[model samples]
Target: MKFAPSWDPTTAIAQQRRDAMLVRLRELRALEQRAVDRSAEARPVFDKRGQLLPRERVGLLLDPGEPFLPLCTLAGYQQDTREAASSIPGGGMVAGIGFVRGTRCMVVASDSGIDAGAIQPMGLEKILRLQEIALENRLPFVHLVESAGANLMRYRVEGFVQGGALFRNLARLSAAGIPVITVQHGSGTAGGAYMPGLSDIVIMVRGRSRAFLAGPPLLKAATGEVATEEELGGAEMHTAVSGLGEYLAEDDRHALGIAREVVASLGWQQERAKLESDPDKDVLLTLMPANLREPVDLREVMVRLVDGGELLEFKPAYGAATVCAQGRIAGHAVGFIGNNGPIDVAGANKATHFIQWMCQLGHAIVYLQNTTGYIVGRDSEQAGMIKHGSKMIQAVTNATVPQLTIQCGASFGAGNYGMCGRAYAPRFLFSWPSARTAVMGGEQAARTMQIVNEAALARKGQRPDPVQAKLQFDQIVEVFESQADAFHTSGLLLDDGVIDPRQTRAVLAFCLDTIAEAQTRQLRPLQFGVARM
Candidate 1:
């Protein structure tokens, strides 16, 4: 009698429905598995430290709850069935509009899964379109590049060629004054390096990335010397020697984080208002040592000068001689450049690039002077110090943005000019009583005067008189005094007077507010287009 209950039609129907549902579920699971397998096959490369994929890196850079508007979803150009196989969304390069730190940004990430994220015709188109969008919308552009090289397969298929188009597009983006950042995640070789090189800021992940105009094989064939990828071009080599990239990140995630912070420091175009913050109380004077001979850490001063401990230092490892950063003063973004007093040619070039990039972003510039001069000797010349120094000066002089100069210590010769001296047309030039502005330091001056005194005594056929020598020395000291006093006494340098070291932050805040209030000119409108390549 109990077994008879299971014979109902309703029970039989329920069993059938369950069977059908299980079959459909199995089919969906199988489809999902196939998709995952395909995706893995496409992306063979993984982050050495985090093992994160390019898509995952993009996700990390974007703000939560914000969706991306994809670019070049249909970049593959094969008309026939077989060619369409390689045609995927994003055309091997994933590009789109996304939010980073609540600010709209145009982003392009090369997907290593597809053709090793090579530069295909379609992919180039996508990049150009994204660049256009960034310029038109006044949004910051972030590039995540990981490519083998230009795709030769596209040329075989149909209409495809490569030339100066990419460079031209980069130039346009630069001229348009949009902040462009590039991240070299993995194997940025050949033409791959150029894109990142042209960007305002280049970030590389240690071990997981390498950037060079040529790969090992090509370099070996050309130079007849075998080398490893790191030996030829790695994070340490670029950041410390070439200064091509601004920062060396521990991983892809760290690189994205750095990019986000940098963008936030630049602020948004719509806001236009300068970033402002409270002055660090009494911290500036305490940062420097009492003895002038003892070297002081410039970073300590930077930490005290900026707001929220927010200082976007550029080429930090490259130029130990000068320090450059973007910081907020009274709610306004300002570029800060100071003497590191122990940097190389690479560091100087980095400083130049940082200033140029900041000017392009429309931020005000501040120069904190304390430098000996350009690195001297044969090794420096070999490193192209003259060329790089000239470039740095060019960037400083040509910058259209407002500039402020603060002579923290000794500012000698060309170093003073590079630090935005009066000749550079700075909006305001302030100095502390401890400031020394001259063509050279006192020791160099003493030597030069001694040499002149010796020549004069030799001509007169007598040793230089001690009394006269003392007077001459006193005169030289007075000359130095006059030059040093210009920042305090002359109205040309400051409207009020020399500020105390403790008031550096407050002075900057006041200057930023004044500039923002006085600047009523509208920004020039930018035109948009695909990069020529």
Candidate 2:
């Protein structure tokens, strides 16, 4: 049956919710800009040194007019400082996927304006995630290097140990045939030297580029030697004697131009044209209710997303709550699994079967999450909820095709794991402004804890004070409610991003196209990464 729209966007409630969502989006955009502005604040210093800012370099490197999707813009928000007001986002780096000479690539630039681009713990994690994405998608990796390396004063032993994975991934990317290009615009010292050392290609700025295992002071301390910065590891020396850098440029802009030329020369081209839906055909389709509490018919959403608004429902009646269907999004065959409610034994079984069948068909799966959790009750326990839910999770974990997720509503308890949450590492995960994620609803969590507290008091033969009990319950609710807000969790790097609900189809289409392109591209893998010598 063709789905019809019942949503009334003109309603007062709808307008109010939209206003709230817009506020959140504005806040998000403002936080993102904080990093840019913070970096841009060093504009004068950069001007004095005759160099472009990090953002400027990124803009110059990317093809004009093409979309640049910034990633992890809030990775270290409220993490680097004690006070939330003072903490800056982006972890001292700017990263995104954008077109470099018409070839989509992952671009990372050091926000040296902030603390000399010292690598924060979250910044390291963000880089690793970017490398993973580039490797997975067979996209070229372009890193604009300039860092003072890890901040020694604030460093931890665990972070130091985990830092090895960063260089290891560089090797892996090269071995997988994906290019690792480095533009050494400023500094690369100590452990940071490996950045340019492992790259498939390195572009170094003549006077400013620096890549040395030990600077003058460290060298003097370790070995009674005297050497100038230029003699030690300057771009001129590296490009001439050490053979570390491949391309030599006069300045940052020149280096960026060379990087663009390098990408243009790669002969990389999209394997197929994007499949865009006809606007005229899709005009009649409407969005589902923005109020997450309202009962959302998954069909209503699917119609707006799929091409021609057609879907092939699977086991529609058996596991009615778990909706599994086959549809095409922007011409790519996709399997979609969405929940109408908690997963029961029947729902788990139905979803597992659907997942396996989709894998067999070589179709990518998109999870539309909206669930409380597996149904919990005496009858559900007897019906083997745990064992059946495990099956569904197993299928999600080991699925052969790419998995993408969008948190449409409540994503609580084991429901998140089963729905390919961030922990599960979906290729991409996005959330709507109305989405809420937690172990359970605030009220339910508070009540469960209240019961537990009461039981403990009974064991001690002490009656609970009414006022104290209410206070504890309210506290639990506040904690859960605050963390579960989409904006708060997004600041913590919980999802790729929080997106506007109206743009869901466009975002999904972009992601699907990225995956499809990766499917058709070929790489030339080597036993080891390209060697500097």
Candidate 3:
């Protein structure tokens, strides 16, 4: 495809904005990292208890020197603004997909280091999505589970209802022949008992792992029974008597080692060819924009990603903002949908057709999101924006082939959903540090609100107060801008992770390879999940 450069990256305005974007990116990263470090506040307690930090457990569980994609690192962000300075993130859990002994698996751990690994509503959302990914991708499920069950004080009935899905998914994984391996680090009780109960292989840390339907106090309250921790459901009792745990280790390190060994023993078939590195590194470096707010020719971005930077543009003249192309990343054939601006009538229709065609061809589609939202105003509605956008949304919702999304820039309003944001369940959705997402841009949203307020006052036959309106608008604008930032949205686990732009190609290649392997592998399904023995 012939390429004419759009925005010049070397321009004074672009360079200045690029530097500012980098600064914001760094700020966001630091903020998220600060939350992670907050878990260290309990590090001394963990050490005293002879346990590793949650992330340290994850590190030891995964194979060394391999990539681990951390999903939903931020959960419960800003939910407690009263403690904004020390608000806990990560939903009291740490989870991601990583390789364990050559097997790509979903590894999740209760971050009991912080707040006893209590279940937060947002953490529940994260785990539910994690389960969907594992099931869809055929990844083996590995959980380092030891949760505080639920916090009744901050609990919602909705969270309680939804939390059942995590348990249901464990059974589903086992029945689907996707092995469920878990290490009960500590306090797997009450609602948490089912974690080990459903796993194909269970590893327990002796003297620490406590898997019980009820603790002693609860048992006494319910049945007037008195029991010690060991009598109730300790690791030794479960492994030796209850037949719940398959392996028992002396300590946290030992348990993780055993879990790794279990993964190594599973002879999962791998048919994926290694992704060959592209020679277009220099081209990708030169073409991709550093400043996300600056309009970018997505063609340049696409060219830098595809194999040898070659692609066949699909209907280039129609829906210019919604770019559709067929190309290969690391020799894997895929379609790409990206945006340079907003999705309009033409853009939505283009996406629908492109998605369907790719589905027919059994090709994966990678979405590079960069749009304010669907077009609005009189002309857009006249052009059937809603109908076409609905059709596009439907196609994205049901496309049979695996979908991946990258939030490279603006992902706002329905545009986020249409572009396969986290809510759309892309096989793997990641974001660049440059990405920003919201219902709408700050100024646009503020103006819309301001207009609505003026109209309301007019309907009441009251004179509109311009000064009061401006104040309200400005406050809303500030709030929107603060939360709409890429880092901010990402800190709430809006995407998988805020990734480096330079690593885009490699990340996409790895994900593509992972999905391809999953598609090729066969499973041995059973009517029921594997029973503990």
Top-lDDT candidate index:
2
Candidate 3 per-residue C-alpha lDDT over 133-177 given as tens digits, one digit per residue, 9 for 90 to 100: 899889999999878888878878887888899899989999999
User: For model 2, what is the error of residue 328's alpha carbon versus the real structure, in angstroms, after optimal superposition?
Assistant: 1.9
- Model 2, span 209-269: residue lDDT tens: 9999999989999998999889999999999999999999999989999999999888886
RMSD of 3: 2.7
Comparing candidate 2 with candidate 3, which one achieves the higher lDDT?
2
Q: Give the C-alpha miss distance for residue 288 in model 3, angstroms.
A: 8.1
Of the two candidates 1 and 3, the one with more favorable TM-score, higher being better, is: 3
Q: Residue-wise lDDT of candidate 1 within 367-405, one digit each (tens)?
A: 887676677789998999888888888888998787888
Off by over 4 Å in 3: 2-11, 82-84, 269-293
Quote the lDDT for 463 in model 1. 93
lDDT of 2 at 205: 99
Report the lDDT of model 3 for residue 141: 91
Point out the higher-scoring one by TM-score: 1 or 2.
2
What are the lDDT figures for the candidates, one per model?
A: 0.65, 0.85, 0.83
